[model samples]
Each structure stands twice: as structure tokens, then as C-alpha cells.
Target: MTVLSYADSALSLLPPVVAILLAIFTRRVLLSLGLGILIGALLLNQWSVLDTGVYLGQRVLSLVWDDGAFNAWNLYILGFLVLLGMITALITVSGSARAFANWARQHIRNRRDAKLLTMFLGCAVFIDDYFNSLVVGSIARPLTDRYYISRSKLAYLLDSTAAPVCVISPVSSWGAYIIALIGGILTAHGFTETGHLSAFVQMIPMNFYALFALALLLCVAYMELDIGAMRKHELNARKGNLYDETKGLPPGANADLPEAETGQVHGLFLPIGVLVVATFYFMVSSGADALAAESLPFTIIGAFEKTDVGSSLFFGASIGLVVTLLLAFIQKIEAKMILKALTSGARSMLPAIYILMFAWTIAGIIGSLETGKFMASLASGNIPFALLPAVLFILAGLTAFSTGTSWGTFGIMLPIAADMAMGSHSSMMLPMLAAVLSGAVFGDHCSPISDTTILSSTGAGCHHIDHVLTQLPYAVLVAVISLGGYIVLGFTESVWLGLASSCVLFLLGLVWLKWQQPKNTNA
Candidate 1:
């Protein structure tokens, strides 16, 4: 009856690897995730039988929307998906799929463009992390598939882009988390000097860990130099070989429609343009000035005043899809045709939407676990000053991975790392804190339990665990190289070396993969 108790949360939630396995094996993400949340709440609440069911939904929703934030702004994230569905629907109704196939029929050149386009989009949406990941993944997945990119590759691109961009952006969720965490740490370190917020402002330019990760992501995308799962998949794709198909995408996701008809796919770009422009305008003009990672609640409220809450930011994008369908209507498209297009788009996202709610629910449960206290305690003590950054990185990674929420991890670890910086002899307090946040994201970006990871896999229509197993090897490699860089960083005291080391390791991996491909092909 009890999933876990307050006294047992440490044991009950440890790793969550089993939870992931069940979700994948049953092909039941929503059920598995919902049960996980229910168990989590029951663990904390210690409720009796009937009361558990009664409190389940109530607790989850309350936790997700306690300050009315989720109700007010979660729409921004989902809105793009809805819009994507709309564009796909309209493309279908306009016979654009046929047109697209026809266009591709004549234009066959390079697969490299797909990888480049994905990286370009990832960098473009640097201001908003969630919007970046979801929109980029949705937009690029189909395009990447055309070039024979694997779903794992697609998820990797999506995952890689999200946190790396967020870490660099002075305005997104990452910004806010660092400010909050660092400010707290500054207080503990007796550096009322600049406050923790100022520490983040100071920290950004010095965060070599995140800077290096972003660099690695771009290098891999640009050079087509694959390593880890990416290198393996590239070799297979090049030889017309396949990955583990049982856990991979269906043929329809990659192939052209069977029995093609004729028309144009003109509206594919409009709604996305609307979403992009609107997000920038709202982010800039809504007067949120989220650059300071200022008040999240106020920012969301301000956005609603014009952006219509988070939903409004993407409203234009969604309507843009409808407008595309309307173009079809104005050109003599039947009402049924438009509605069917819209309907198809909505249906396509049903699975993702359902799973997202469960993901949100689990996140709520983890947040309730009071991660801030746990991480803060861990950061206290006589650890070596030089090893502080690496330790913070690993701890932040663990907290984020276990909690399934990087924001929560940031809330808990950033301040702690900042405090460690204060207590230590190092003058690079800001850099140390940056390492903490970046490390949290390293694990969060790849963890099976992480909501972002789930969302990315969902966006690509890939099996989530498949994304995890394949992506882990690469994420771990980057972490290890970065860790080595951090170790030498203590003596060199140079951010450049850390960045250079990450780049070098990535290139080395690329070369190794290329050399091994002949063997892989021969075998």
C-alpha cells in the first residue's frame, strides 16, 4: 500500500532505473509515471488505502500549481507542440506531403544539412530552454530522419541543445536557477559583497564546463564526426544498415507516404516563425527582463498581460497553423478538410501531452522531497578546495538526475556550490558555482528520470529508455573529459584549457569512431 515513506525516500527513489524499465517494457509511460508519482506521494503522505487515491490527483496538481505558476505558464511549452501538429495537419490537407516528396524527388544532395539545421535552430532559441528543446526537436526530427539520422541521434541533438543553450543564456530558466542558488551560497560564504545574484552575473563568462559542452555539441553537429552512439549510428546510416529496430522508429516516420497525391507544402514554415517571433517579443517586451532570472512568477504574470500567459506566447504560432489551413479554405478548401487537418494535428500529440502530465506529477513529488536541504548539507565540510568544483558537479548531477528536474537541482545545488566557493581558498568562486550548475545539467540532460529527457524522447517519438541507454555513453564521456579538465583547471587556473580539453576529447572520439567504422562495416 505504501510506495515509500518519508523515512524511506532515500531507498525508494534511489536511481529510479527500475521505474524506467517498467515504463519502457510495458510501453506505458503515462501509467508507469503516474504510478511512480502516486507511490512517491503515498511515501510522503503515509496515507491509508482509500485516502491514497483521493489524495493522488489533488496532491500532484497542487504541487505542480501551488503558486498558480503551472496553470499560468505550462502552456508555453505545450503550445508549440500543438502548433507543430497543426502544421503537419495543414501540410497533409494541402497535399504538401506529396509536394514535399516531389520536391525531394528532384533535389537530392546531402544529409549534412539536416545536422547543421538542427544545431542552428538550437542556438537560435538560446533565450528559453524549454521552448528551445521542444520546438527544435519537433522541427528537426522529421528533417533529420530524411537524412537517415537515428532517433537516438535526434534525441541527442535535442538534449544537447536544451541545457547547453540554457546555461549560456542570461535570460532563461537556467539563469534564474543560478541566480537563486548562487545568491544563497554567497550569503553563506560571508560575501554579502555582491550577493549571489551578482555572482551569477559574474559567473557566466567563467563557466567553462557549460561553455565546453556547447562547443562539443556544435563541433559534432558541424563536422559530422560521430562518436559514442552518434558515431555508431552515423556509420550504420551511411551503409544503409539499421539500428535495433525493435526499439526504434517505425518505417512511416522515416519514409515517404504510400500512394502519393499532388499539391504544395507551403505553410510548414509560417506557424514556427510565428512562435519564434512571438517568444522573442514576449520575452523582450513583456517587460519581464528575465535576463536577471528575475521573479519567475512576476515574469509569467507579465507575459499573460499580453502573451496570454505561457499559452499566449505560442498562440500566434498555433493560430498561424490555423491561418495556413484557412489559406487552404480561402482557396476553396472544404470546412471538413480544415477541421480534419486540425484534428489530425491534435491527435498526433495526444500521447506526448498525456505523458507530460505524468512527468509533471513526478517532478512535483521530487520537489516535495526537500532537495535543497540535502544538497546544502553535502556541500558543507572539509573537502579539498581544488576538487570542490568537480565534487559540486557530481553532486549537482546526482541531485538533478534523482529529482528529474534540473531547475530543482539548481535550486538546491547552486547555492551550496557558491557557499563552498566562499569557504574555499580559491578566488574563482563564480567559476566553481558555474561548474555546479553545468554538472547538474550534464546528468539532467541524459537521465532517464529527467523530465527534459522524457520530453525530448517524446518529441522525437522515440522510446525513452532507448534514448537513455544510447545517449548515456556519450554524456558520460563528455562528463569525464570535463572532469579531467576541471582537475587540471585547479593548477592552470585557466578556463581556456577546460574548454580546449573538451574540444580535443570530442575530436579524438570522432577520429576513433571514423577509424573503427571500417571494422564495424566489415563485421
Candidate 2:
């Protein structure tokens, strides 16, 4: 599909809004995404029905085949998802999950401990959001389930920590990508006061949303905080309902698998350990190969910057699946049962795979529509210097929300932000850029179409809409507080002062929530 002449106009916002609203109200993800893509096609084709149909069909087909070639990245990611599902199912059939749950029960004394442990695991797996979401959720689900912790709550913990932690850690995939983007932006704008890595470190304090989101997760866990639809989910979970049965089994769920009584804890630990180590090694190794091809030195950061994450994840998951199969064989599980687990596991991931395809297609249409260009345009022309950071945060959030991608938003908005700052608010460049990062994460954190959000729900075996509805309030509250912090940073030109104010505000917000809860209720 070609870019429409009015691509940068307000008209570009209509499809995403229509899709998001439909998804929220009807809880039908694929239907909503399909309609959105159709609507976008209509707009691009000037409302010609046949043209719209053709364009929409082409875009959907382009997911697997584009420009006379296969789309390797998308296919690789799909392969990884399938392999991850098989591995998870095998673990359950082998009773590794139950065995680990039994082992964890000895160490985790109560529900609070379970929740806290989940948060800690989420934070620990910060190398990649996709890896973190699945691994942490798989490791923590059994323990959380043992304590009757809600799957929605577990999903919230996973979703909140993945991007927020990754966005801040310099060694993370998100960090390396953003650092490379920053390097280019800095070079283009002739800013040499700091290198890309140092600039990222400096901006960490100013990234109010990421910091506040992490803090909010800690407070929610320790304080047993339950906001919005989450409260109902928690109430249900306490009664042994981990998720809404009316909605059917969620993605990654395999309730029919029987537990093997003889399973050992190592059955779970060794596979996950292998997955992490293999994935990390592949990421670095593949990154190094890319560097070698370019005649560049092999530094960890440089390797990460050029690494093909999709293929790396695919390779890692494949190796992990082999290990999982070996463990099952060692335990003397029936071959028939092992084969069943593989088929069933792949089947379970079908919904997520479908939703992901729709999401990517719509995101592609959104790109052609120039949604981010229109969004970034909103921040130009006449903004006051003190309000620049706040405006950028809002714009970035809106852009990411509409496009369902933080990295795409970063690509669109970062250079615009650099230009805006260098053109006038020179001293506020770091804060403005930080606000974009903060907002992008904030938007991506809650958006229904976001891959991380979808994976978080899948990992926790919670309904996708349930995760989105439950997590939205918490994400919003943190964003509001972060917005206030950016406003302060903009005016004061002091990152510390802004950060301090956000911290105080976050605490106050927590206190208010505590006051609102009924004294006798557990949540």
C-alpha cells in the first residue's frame, strides 16, 4: 500500500482509535484489528471498496511474503512462540512445573512472598522483554497459583517489569537499540557533550515513567495493591479461580496435562537455565557475527546493537526445547504423551499467533499512514520550553499507543525531539528525549495490541483482555505521576528535583489507595 496524501493529517488517528475502542468494549481482539486494518485501507484507497479490499488483502499477505520474498523476522518470531509453547507444555506433562511449585512452597511462606518473588524474577530477566515475559511468568506461575494469586495480577507484574527494566538497563536489547538511535541523533544535531552510553545513563533519572512504574510494581506487591478490574480478579483467585473460566483457556494454558508424581525440581530449573544461557550466548554470538561482517570490533554493546534478535530467540528456544524433550525422556514419559504435548502446546499458542499477525499487519498499515509523523507534528511550532518535556511525553505515548510499538515511536520521535531541543531548548535536550522514552514505554506497557502486553498475558495464562483491562489503571496512574515529574523537570531544568517530586507523588498515590481499601479486605 502506498502512503496517502493525507497520511500526516488527523485522519491517520481514526483507525487505531476505532480498533482500540472496539477491542476494549467488545473484548474481541482479532475482529477489532481486522476492522481497523480495513478502515485504514479504505482511507488510503480513498474509500474505494474494491481498492480497500485489495490493499487490505495485500497487507495481510505481506506478513509472511513481502516484495517477492519471505519475511524472515516475523516468521522467526512465530517459530520461537511455537517452540516456547511446546517447551512449556512438556514441562507441565513431565510435572516439572508442579515439582518446582512444591519446592518453592518450602521457601515461599505466603501470598506476599509469592508476589514479591514474581516481581524479583521479572526484574532479573531483563535481557529482552519477550524472553523476560515468558521465562518469568513460567517460573512464577506455579508459585503464584499455589498461593491463589490471580493470573491477571501475575501478568501485571510481568508486563510492568519487562519494558520498564529493559528500557533502563544498558545491556538490554531495548537499551542497545535506543543507544544506537541516540548516537545517530546526537551526531546529526552536533551535540558532543556526552557519548551515547553516558547520555542514556544520565537520562535514566529523567525517565520518570520507567522508574515510577518499577517503584509502583514494588509497592503493589508489598502492599497487596489491587486497582480497577484487578480487584475482581483477585477476589476470584482467592476462591481458586486463577482466571475467568467463561472466557475459556487463555493462550499458553494446558489444563488437561497430568502431573508426573516422580518429577524433580531440576526438571524445571535445568531447562530454564539452559534457555537463558543459550539465548544469551546466541544473542552475543550473532551480534558478533554481524560486527565481523562489517569489519567492526566485537564489543558486547556493539554486538547487541547489530544482533538479529528474532533469529537468536528462535535458535535459543529450539535448543531449550531439545533439552526439555531429553528431560521428559529421562523421566520415562510415554512417547505418545510426549508427542501429544508437542501438538497440544503448538495448538495452544495459535490464538497468540493469530493476534500477533493481525497486530503486525495493522502496525504496518499504521506506518504507511504516517501516524507517528502526524503525532510528532503536534509537538512542533509553538510549544513553551518548560512544557516541552511534558508535551513530548504525551505525544510519544499517543504515538506508541496508536502504532502499538515503542521502537517505531522512538524512530519517529527521537530525531524530532533532538531537533526541537537543539533549535531552542538546548539545556533540556536530555529531559525531552527521556520523556519520549518514558512515554513510549508507558503507552506500550498498556496498549492491547502491544506484543509485550500480549506475551505477558500468554505467559501468565490469563485472558488477554483481562490483562489489559486490569493493568490499565495502574499504568495510567504511574504515567500521570510521571507526567507531573516531566513538568517539573521542564521548568526547573533539574532531573533530581523532578525525580524527587515524582517519588513523593508516587508514595502519596499509594497512601491514597491504601486509605481507599476496606480495612478487612485482603487486597
| Alpha carbon lDDT of each predicted model | 0.62, 0.89
Task: Give the runs in model 2 whose Cα sits over 4 Å from its true position.
Answer: 1-5
Model 2: per-residue lDDT, tens digit, 310-415?
A: 9888999999999999999999999988998999999999989998898998888888889889999999879898899999999999999999999999999999
Please, what are the lDDT tens digits per residue for candidate 1 over residues 253-327?
A: 322222214455454455466667766666555545443355555553233222322554466466666567665
C-alpha TM-scores of all predictions: 0.81, 0.98
lDDT of 2: 0.89
TM-score, cand. 1 vs. native: 0.81
Weakest lDDT window of 10 consecutive positions for candidate 1: 251-260
Model 1 stretches with alpha carbons more than 4 Å out: 1-9, 15-17, 21-28, 61-70, 97-108, 171-173, 176-209, 222-266, 288-309, 500-504, 519-523
* Candidate number with greatest TM-score: 2
- What is candidate 1's CA lDDT for residue 315? 61
Model 1, position 347: C-alpha lDDT score:
67
For residue 296, what is the lDDT in candidate 2?
97
